[model samples]
Target: MNVRPAEPMFVSVPPRPQRLLHSEAYIKYIEGLQADSKYISNWDKQLRANTENTPVPDQSRLPTHWLGNGAGNHGSVVNALWMLRDFMMKDALGINKTI
Candidate 1:
């Protein structure tokens, strides 16, 4: 009796080319928007407000674990499954924590 190697079960197809909206004119239009004084002033005001208004929370005062009635407790199974999928995908792709 002779044994044969298993054949491939699926064929790989090349991905379709992506059409990006980064033409020269579009880039120039974006650059013009960035250079506009009103846009610059709005962004500057937003940045200043964001930096000045918000205060960082004290991490030491935060809860160490999820509460029994919290959203995490309700979706614990879903979260565990998602974590498993992510771990498997990372292991398969050889990705590190930094990635």
Candidate 2:
């Protein structure tokens, strides 16, 4: 599913004005990551929208007792989301191969 970006996303890390690694491939990889990071904000928004609308069976809905316990807390969800998002962005940028 191709989702359009909702808003401009600034990369937390800026591009390296000068290549410190001195390898063409490495420099190219960094450039790709910079480009991917620019899309991160939109990507996250799409991911959130997708996840939010996911259908959960009423019978399987967690009770209040289980809401924030057993690895299902907000922190865990946020961490997992970030990890997945980072992985997807890196894959899109082809950093997976370089790594």
lDDT per model, in order?
0.52, 0.53
> Model 2: per-residue lDDT, tens digit, 1-99?
999878757657877688555666567655657553655244555456544565434533333343344335435544444445557766777965787
Kindly list the per-residue Cα lDDT of model 1 for residues 33-82, writing each as its tens digit: 75446653344443344323644355444343433443354365334434
Model 2, poorest ten-residue lDDT window? Answer: 59-68
TM-score per prediction, in order, is 0.23, 0.23
Which stretches of model 1 miss by more than 4 angstroms?
A: 1-4, 22-29, 35-99
Q: Candidate 1: deviation at residue 44, Å?
A: 18
Candidate 2 regions exceeding 4 Å error are: 1-75, 95-99
